[model samples]
Target: MTNDEKVRSIRSKIKCMKSTNEQGFDVIIWMRKRFLQSEAFVKNLKRIIDAGFIEKWTNYLNLQDISQRLLAREGAIKDPEIKFEEIKTIFVLLLVGHALAASVLILELWYSKRSRKY
Candidate 1:
C-alpha cells in the first residue's frame, strides 16, 4: 500500500483502539499494547521507521510526543544531561525539611525537660 493509504489505515486502527477520553497516559498505554500485543501494528510501525517515514507518520497522527517516548523506551534516544542545579535544589529542600523536623523534636524535648522541673 501507498504511504498515504498506510497512514489512513494506521490512523483509523489507532482511533478505534483508543478511548474517547484518551490523554497522554492513555496514549502511552495504547502504544505499549500495540507494540507488545499487536504483531501487525508493530510490523507496520517498523516499516514506517525503516522507510524513513516515522516522522511523517507521527506528525500525521499527532503523536510526536509518543514517538519520542517510544524512541526513548527503545533506547534510540540518549539520556539528557543531568543538571547539578536541580539536584542541588532538591538536596537543599530535603535538608530544610530535616532541619525543621529536628528543630521540632528539640523543642519538644526542651519543653518536656522544663515541665519536669516545674
Candidate 2:
C-alpha cells in the first residue's frame, strides 16, 4: 500500500483502539509504532516544520517548560534511570508529535480538496 494509505489506516486504527479499553498502554506503543514512525507521517512532519508550524505549535504548547520538567525528571532518576513519570513525559511528547503530524496531514488534505472545489 501507498504511504498515504498506510497513514490513513494507522489513523483509523488509532481511533478504533482509542474507543476500547483492552489495549491500555499498548495503544500508545502501537500508535508510536504505526503513526510516529510511518514514512508518510515523517515526510508531512518535515513539510510542516519547513513551513514553520513546529515553531508556532511549540510556542503555543510552551515546550520549553515541558523540556525543563523532563530534564528535572531525568536528573531525579538514579541507578536504573527509568521512572514512570519519565516514561509518561516521553509518551506525552510522542503524542504531541503525532498530533502535529496528523494536523499537517489534515490541513494538506483540506487545502487540496478546497483547491479542487474552486
Q: What's model 2's TM-score? A: 0.31
Candidate 2, 55: how far from true, in Å?
Answer: 45
Model 1 TM-score relative to the real fold: 0.37
lDDT of 1: 0.61
- lDDT by residue (23-112, candidate 2, tens digit) is 322222233534545785546645765687644654645655566668788896345667788799889999999999999999999989
- lDDT scores for all predictions? 0.61, 0.59
Which stretches in model 1 have alpha-carbon errors above 4 Å?
Answer: 1-66, 69-76
TM-score, per-candidate, Cα-based:
0.37, 0.31
Kindly list the per-residue Cα lDDT of model 1 for residues 1-118, writing each as its tens digit. Answer: 7444554555544422222224422122244422444556656665765675744554556576667768889889976798898699899999999999999999999999989953
How much is the lDDT of residue 44 in candidate 1?
A: 69
- Which residue pairs overlap in candidate 1's backbone? none
